[model samples]
Target: MKRINEQKGFTLTEILIVLVVAGILLSLILPNVLQAIERGNVTAHQSNLNTINVALFMCYTQERDWTQCADITDLTDGNFLEEVPENPFGGGYDIEDSPDVAAGDINAGKVACSTVEVTVGGDTLPGTCSGA
Candidate 1:
């Protein structure tokens, strides 16, 4: 009687097929991962803005006035916040004075007294009041 040997491992074709499937799966997942990271950055910017707003409100309550704190440096100097929050996209905060608008104006809704307009990546999130 003669004995025959059986296959012990995967063939080369099977290994190549597995590699191709893995590559396809990675291609589908990579973009979504990158997009999530970008969105996380945006969320961080928004959270920073909200923190500044709270600090400004606290300052206003103590000072009893709606006045800009000289600048971002002043906010840090007065200990409202540990330091000025930087825009996640890039650059520092874009400080702007509010225009004189009546109690009810279309633009008024987008403007806050003594506001600090934070421009991230050239896109402005309006009505961020730093003093009021």
Candidate 2:
């Protein structure tokens, strides 16, 4: 009796080669995607900080005074802010009355701004929101 010789499925070596290729492709693609996501998060964080700063600045304008803001609630309670934006990295958003630099102080300088900070990936990044 004559038997037909036909490949029924992929060989073990072929499967391993395909897996290796897939792994290489994934290795090349994953980092860029992750980086893009991280950049997006950072941008969103900055936008939120800017929004908070603007609201605080407007509040200061309404009060016609320059005071350090410790909490975002003051803006909300005063109706300057409808709500506080949530941090993307599961860290609390902080507002400081003074900036890290002498030039960033709203009270001292013409800059109407605040020092905002948040922790991202266990790293604390500070940003300044200025009225100018």
Task: Say which candidate scores most in lDDT.
Answer: 2
> Candidate 2: RMSD over Cα atoms?
4.6
Per-residue lDDT tens digits for candidate 1, residues 1-132, read 756876689999999999999999999999999999899988988898787777766665676544545355656777888988867788876444456543243224443454455676777766544532
Clashing residue pairs in candidate 2 (N, C-alpha, C atoms within 3 angstroms)? 68-97
- The local distance difference test score of each candidate is 0.68, 0.73
Q: Residue 55 lDDT in model 2?
A: 87
RMSD of each: 6.3, 4.6
Model 2 poorest ten-residue lDDT run = 97-106
Off by more than 4 A, model 2: 4-7, 67-70, 99-132
User: Which candidate number would show the highest TM-score if scored against the true structure?
Assistant: 2
